[model samples]
Target chain A: METLAELEPGKSPDVPQVLPPEPVVEIKASRTWLALNLKEIWAYRELLYFLTWRDVKVRYKQTLLGVVWVVLQPLMTMVITTIFFGKIVRVPSDNLPYALFVFAGLLPWMFFSKAITQSGSSLVGSANLITKVYFPRLIIPSATVLSGLVDYAVSVVVLIGLMIYYGVGASVHLLMFPVLIVLMTILALGVGMWLSALNVKYRDVAAMIPFLVQVGMFATPVYYPSSLIPEKWQWLMKLNPLTGIVENSRAALFNRPFDWLSFNISVGIAVLLLVSSAYVFRRMEKSFADFV
Target chain B: MQSIITVENVSKQYRLGTRDASYGTLRDSIVRSIRAPFSKSQSKKGNGVETIWALKDVGFEVKPGEVVGIIGRNGAGKSTLLKILARIVEPTTGNIKLYGRVGSLLEVGTGFHPELSGRENIYLNGAILGMKRAEIERKFDEIVAFAEIEKFIDTPVKHYSSGMYMRLAFAVAAHLEPEILIVDEVLAVGDAGFQKKCLEKMRDVGEHGRTVLFVSHNMSAITRLCKRAILLGDGQVLADGTAHKVASSYLNSGLGTTAVREWQDLEKAPGNDIVRLYAIRVVDEDGQLTDVVDIRKPIGLEMEYAVLNPYHILVPNYHFYTEEGVCAFVAQELDEHWRTTPRPLGRYKSTVWVPGNFLSEGTMIVGAAISTMDPVTIHFHEQDAVAFQVVDSLDGNSSRGDYAGHMPGVVRPMLQWHTEYHVKEN
Candidate 1:
C-alpha cells in the first residue's frame, strides 16, 4: 500500500514546513468620524449581558438591604417631595392628587438623575478596568444606566401602591409609559456620555455632579405642571427637555391629553443631544486610559 | 501563519497637567469661550501647551502563532505601546492595524469587584477581556482548577488572600482565547511555583497558534518563551531580533552602570552638617574600578566624607541590599576601641571588605552613614550610596548547582556542609 504522504503528490515537492502567515491588514488614516459598529456590538450581545448583570450584582452585593435599597431610595425621595413641595409650597398638580402627580414626575426624573450621576463617575471609579483591558469604553456608562433601571422598576411599584391608596383609576393611555421611559433614558445617557468623558480628564466634574443635580431638580417641572406657566413662557419651558417628559407622563397617566408642541421639541432635542454627545464621547474615548 | 497585529510609526503624545484644571468652573469656562473669539492669545498659545511624546515613531508586526517580548527599563514606553495596541489609548500619530480580537492583561485583578465572589469576578474579568459568557462557562472548571481555589469560589474576593486573588486573576487572563494577548509584568507577583505554572500555560497558549506580546524584567523567562524580543530605551526601540541576541545586547549595554556622579548639593543629600558624603566608589581587592565583583574574592567599598567638627566617638555603618531593594546585611562599628578616638575636621575615609562566598550571583547596593557616639548622634546618612554586581562562587563543579544558579532572599552565605557514610552490611 502507498504511504499517506506519497498518496498526495502536491505535498511531496520540497516538503518545506508550512508556517501560518501573519495578519496583514493595513489601517488607513482618514478624517475623524463617528460610527457605532452596532453589528459587532450585537454579535457580542452575550458578553454585554454578562457585563450588565455583573454590574447589578456587584452594586447590590454585601449591602444590608440587598435589592430592597432600590425600592427605598425613590420611595424616600417621593415622600420628601410630598412634604416639602406638595404640602409646604403648594405647587399645582393639574387637578390630580398632589402626591400622585409629583410621584409621576418624580419617577422619570429620579431615573434620569440617578443614571447621569452614576454613569458620570463610572469611568473614574473603574480606573483599573479601563487601564488594563480592551473593551468598548461606552459599555461602562451604558451598563451603569441599565443597572439604575432596576431601581426605577422597583419605584414604579411603589407609585402603583400610592395610586391605589388614593382611589385613582388607571387610564388606557398609561401604555405609553415605556416610551416616556425610553425618552428619559436617552436624555440621561446623552448628558452622561459627556460628563463621563470629561470626568476622566477633570475629576472636578465628578465632584460637582451632586450640586448640579440639586439645581436641576428645581429647574425641572417635577413638583408643578408646565401648564401653570403663561402660554408664551411655556415655549421657553419646553426648551428644558425634562419639561415635555414630566408633563406628558402626567397627561398620559391622568387622562390628560399630550402636549404635541412640547413633546415634539423634547424628542427632537433628545435625539440631537444623544447623537452629538455620543460622537464626542467616541472621539475622546480613545485617550481615556492614558488620561484617566 | 498570518500577521495578527501591525504597528507602524505609532506615537502617543500627552499634555501632563493638574487633574482638575484651575480654570475649570462653569463661569471661567464661559468667560474663556467668549474671550476665544476676541483674543489672539488663544490662537498663539495653542502652541504653548507643553507636550511629551510617550511613544516615538515605533513600528513592528506580530505574526500569528508568534510570541514576542518587549523588554525595557521603567518608563521606556513599553506600557504605552501595549495600551495603544490594546486600543485602550489612541496614538497621537501613526496607526496600528489589528486583525482580530485583542486581550490585554495590563494589571491583575483590574475589573474584579471586591464585593463580588471569586466566581463572579472570574466571569466579570473574562467579559472585560472580551470573552463571551458561554466561552467563559466552557472553561469555567479549568479556570477554577488552575487557580486552585475551589472552596473559595463562592466567597467574596475581598475575603480572599492576596495570593489567591492573583492566582484567580491570572487564570482568567490565561483562559482568554483572543487572537492576540498583551501581558505586562503581572507575573512578578505570586510564588515561584505559580509563576512557573503560568509560564507553562503561556507557552501552551502560544503553541495553539495565538500571538502574544509579553513585557517583563525577567530576562531568563523572556529568553525561554519569546522567539523575538524588542528592547526599548528612552521611548524608542533600541533593538529587535531573536530573544537571546536582544537580551544579550540589553544586558551588555552598560545600562546598569552606576559610576556616573549625579549627586545634588550637600544640602540636598540626606546628611547632617557634621559629616557629609562627597563620593562613593566600588573597587576590587587590588583597588581597580570594576562593575562586576566576584563572590570568591574580597570586594572593597571606599567612602569619602568631610567632618565639620571634632568628635569623641565616630561610627561608620555600611548596609548591603539585593538588586530587588531588600537589605541583605548591615555592618556597624560598635567596638569600644573606635569610640575613644577623636577625629579632626577634614576629609575622612572608610573601607569595608566583603569576604569570599558571602553573596550569590546577583546585583547589590551599598549605603553608608557616619555618626558620633557618647550620646550617639547621626551625622551623615546616605541611602543607595553605590551599586555593584556579584557573581556566584560555586560553578557547575559544586553538587548543589541549583543553589548556585539563583538564590532567594537578600544574603547568600556559605554555610558548613558535611557528608558521612558508614558500612553496616557484612
Candidate 2:
C-alpha cells in the first residue's frame, strides 16, 4: 500500500505557502434565473482541464491500437455509409465524388454525435464523482464535449486525406473550419446539457438518446447533400442546425461558396440553444446528487 | 473566531419515491394525458407527493478553527445536513452562508479512474477536490509519499490494493487546503492505524484555524475530535453541547428498556427486498432474553431475520460498540454447514455468544448486519439496533477486581499471568 511520509511537527520541510483560500462560498437553496455562476466555473477551470484530460487518457488506455481507433471509427463509418447510400442507392453527391461528399458530412456529424452522446451521459457516468465532491456540475458535460474534440481532430485528418485523394483543393474558406467546429461543439453541448440534466431525473433520456442520434443522422445531410432536398424544404432542414454546420463546413472543406443565410441561422440557433440549455442545466444541477 | 458557517432555518424535503412533477417519461406523460380529465378527482394527490423532511428548520453556526461533529443514526439527516453544507444537495427552504472555500470529502477518491495511473489520478482527484493545478503540483510528491504508493506511482490504480487506493485517495483529500472541510462517514474505511493518522490530520486541519464539519456514527471520533457535538434525531437538532455530554446523551438514549425489538408491520421494518430484520435481543447465559447481563457469565446476541432473496449467500453479524463508540468486537457465526449451501427463503435465527469475563461493564450498542461476500455488499446494516449493559457486582470473579473508579478499556479480558522471581545479577 502507498503510504505518505508522516510530517513531523515544525521541523519537516515542504510546508506549503498557504494562499488565502477563496472567500464567501455561499451555498443557497435558490438563486436567480441567470445564476450561471461563471466565476465559480472559472475558478475551477483546471478541474475542467483535468477532467477533459482524464477522458482522453482513459478512453484509449490498454487498447491494442489506442488512438488509431479514433480515426478508424469515422473512416470505417464513412466507407460503409458511402457504399450503401451512394453506390447502391445512387444518392447525388452535388457533383463531388461520393466518398469525399459523405466523408465531409460525416466529419461534423461524428464530432457532433460523439460529443452529444458522451456529454449526454457524462453526468450519470460521473455519479461517483458527483455525489462525493462539489464543483460546478456544468464542467462535467462541457469537459466531455471538449474531450470529443480529440477524436474529432483525428477524424478530420481522415477527411482531409479523402479530400486530397479526390483532388479537392483547400480554399481560403478553410479558415472557417475551426469556427464551424466550435459551433458544432456548442450545439452538442447544448443538447448534451439538456439531456444529461434530464438523464439524472429520468433515465429515459439515456435510452432515448441513441434513437435521437440515429434519427438526427438521417435528418441531417450525412448520406445526401442538402441540395438533394427540394428548395422549399431546405429551410426546414436548416432548422436542424447541423444542416448549416455540416454543409457549410463541407463548403469550406471543398472550397465551395458558403451559404451565408442558413449558416447564420445555424450559428444563431446554436448560441441560443447553448445559453438556454446552460440555464436549464444550472437550474437542475442542484437536484442531481439527490437523484443520481 | 468568526462564524464560518451559518445555517438559518434550513429544511430539505424529498419526495418519497421519485422526483416530483419533473422529468416525467414519455410513458408517464402519455398515460397522464390520456387519463387527464378522467383522473382529475384522483389527481388531488398532486404529483402523488409524499415527502420526508431530511432536515427541518435546523440551524447552527460554527466558529472558524472549531471542529463540530454531527452525530445521528441512519436517516437522521446527518448525511443530508452534510450534503446541504457541502452544497451537494440544496435545502428545500431557508438559507446557509459560508464565508470561506469549502472542500467536501463525502467519500475518498471521488474521481479516481481505474484505468488511469496513480500519478494521473492524483492530479485528477485533487482537481475534483477543488485544489488548483499549482497546488496539486506543489503537493504532488508529498501526496505520492503519503499514499506510500511511490513504487506504483505510474501504475494503473485498478491494480492497486484496496488499501493503497484508499491511502492515495485520502492523501489527496487531506492535503486540500480549503478554509472549511466537510467530511462524512469516510473515516469508517481504511485500517485502524491509517484512520488514526487521518483523525490526526483532521485535528491539524482544525487547529490551523480552518473549520471542519465532520459527520460520523463513530462516537469515539465525535467525542475526541469535536468540542461541540450536535445530536440529530429525525432531522431535528436534539441536543447541542460539549462532546462528552452529547455523546453520552446519544449512548444513554440507546439504553432505556429496549433491548429486544420487533416490528409487526413489514412495510415499516428497516430492510429491503434482500432481507428483513424480524426481531433482535440480548440474552443471558441461560438463553433467556435480558438487557442486563452478569459480567461473569456468557451473554448472547440473537438476531432473527427473514431472507427475502434466497439467491445470495448472507452472513448475519454484530458489531458491539462500547458506550464511548469504540467497537469492542465484531462477532459473526461461521456455521460451515451453511456456508456453501443456499437456503430457501425463510425466517432464520442466528445467535452469537460473547464469553464471560470479556466485556467491560458498560452499555454496549449492537450494530446488526446482513451482507454478502465476494462482491462485498451489505444487504441491510442497522447501527445501534440494540443495547445491553454488563454489571460487575464486586464478585471478584472477573477482571475488574473491584477497581471502582473507572474501567478505561473496551474489554476487560481476564488473562492469566504466570510469574517467576529472579535474583538481581548486577
| Per-candidate local distance difference test | 0.75, 0.82
In the order shown, the candidates' DockQ scores are: 0.28, 0.34
Give the per-residue lDDT of model 1 (tens digit) for A158-242.
8889889988778887977788889888888888888898887667798889998897787779877888888888777888888
lDDT of 1 by residue, B352-397 (tens): 7778667654567787878765687877677777777665534543
Tens-place lDDT digits, model 2, residues A1-292: 1111122222222222342344376666786465588888898899999989989988899898999999888779878978898899989998898888888888788888888888888899888878877888999999999999888888888777777788899889999998998888888888889988988877788899899999999899888988889999978988898998999988888888899887898889889988999899988888888777
- How close to the true structure is residue B85 of candidate 2, measured as C-alpha lDDT? 87
Off by over 4 Å in 2: A1-23, B17-24, B29-43, B255-281, B284-299, B302-410, B413-426
Question: Across residues B242-353, which tens digit of lDDT does each residue of candidate 2 receive?
Answer: 7657766776565233578877887777788878988888888778877767677898888888888788778889998865556888887688966666556999999998
TM-score of each: 0.79, 0.80
Which ten contiguous residues of candidate 2 chain B have the minimum total lDDT?
B249-258
| iRMSD (1 decimal) for each model | 9.1, 6.8
Segments of candidate 1 deviating more than 4 angstroms: A1-30, A43-47, A202-204, B15-42, B48-50, B256-426
Chain B TM-score, one value per candidate, order as shown: 0.68, 0.70
